[model samples]
Target: MEYGCYVCNKIIKTGEKFTFTKEGPVHMDCFVAAERKKVPEGKAEYLRNLSMILDYELTMLVSLLSLKSEDKETSELIRRRINAIEKQAGETTGLIYNL
Candidate 1:
């Protein structure tokens, strides 16, 4: 069975070093990156802060899509970028729901 990295949402290849959280297995680098991130003052604060970031990312993605790039590779890359951002936004929403 293939496991996914929590941060990148990419497959964690066999034999890779990872750490387990209450959520699931995450690559060591991903875990460290999360650890180094600044903690919010409170749940409401965290949600508000993340919401702003998510909003900006979504706005950027929408703007890019409006340009209607003809390059297949560029379009595919944008789709992947949007997917990754949406996934992270969902995870953040889940955290708020849990609290």
Candidate 2:
């Protein structure tokens, strides 16, 4: 059976190194490149932006885990921000595929 890559939205043939996530199967290299592209232009800017984003995600995850049951609104807001950041990261990393 043919499987589709989550990042490139293309068919993944046999003998490809891939991992399965909740979303779907994704090629290993595609996933790594996508993660690397989640930053600004220039090496320095990219590193800085990536570090900040990772830190923010970590902090939000911690806060989300510690939130009280009644604070549904606050939890939802944080979740939305996290989702936005993830989407931006994915978009920034221009998708590349191997033939």
Candidate 3:
């Protein structure tokens, strides 16, 4: 199935990069940037929390793009940013590992 970005109205194919949002489908870059804009300056904790939310959202994205796995790459960029946020806040990934 071909998904069209609600913002750009561009035809987006599975794994071609799209973000699932309450507002509907949007480009991945658009989604990430919008998410980043929501974070306030000097708020590492907020950033960390945002990262967690993004990570969970990305996990859902992965599932949605399951059929496009052959041409898809995991949202590693978001993961890296999340890791950095965790590191900056002196938090560890294992914090939630036990849950």
Candidate 4:
């Protein structure tokens, strides 16, 4: 079955990851950003922006880490920034690892 993310109203296809929030289906990225608490509740635009930024950061971090395995300090810094996101959530990935 397909569900739409309440924050972005985008279809979350079957087998794709999503969260079941009080508001309804939400993408993993959207749920992560919303849980971060930097944005006020009910503000879809801000949530969307934060969600995209989180996705971008995760992508960049992955690419950078793959190319430069020796940069522990910088990698740790990025990991900290991500961990500061502040909570554990129910996700579909086998890796319970958070950003």
Candidate 2 overall lDDT versus native: 0.55
Q: Write the per-residue lDDT of candidate 2 for residues 4-92, one digit (tens) a residue.
A: 99899988865554545456777655665665575335464555454455445445544554555458887787677657755543443
lDDT of each: 0.60, 0.55, 0.51, 0.54
Rank ordering of all candidates by lDDT, starting from the highest = 1, 2, 4, 3
> Where's the lowest-lDDT run of ten residues in candidate 3?
90-99
Candidate 3 C-alpha lDDT tens digits along 1-95: 56777767888765554445556766655554555565456654655665566465555545543533233244555455545543432232223
lDDT by residue (tens digit), candidate 4, 4-86: 99878899865454556567878777666556554445655554554565455445444443443358987787566545432
Clashes of 2: 0
For model 4, the run of ten residues with the poorest summed lDDT: 90-99
What are the root-mean-square deviations of the candidates from the true structure over C-alphas? 11.1, 9.6, 11.2, 10.0
lDDT of 1 by residue, 28-78 (tens): 556544643644446556655555564565455456545557899988987
Please report the TM-score between candidate 1 and the true structure. Answer: 0.45
Which pairs clash in the backbone of model 4?
Answer: none
Question: Which ranges of candidate 2 are over 4 A from the true structure?
Answer: 39-99
Residue 8 local lDDT, model 1: 81
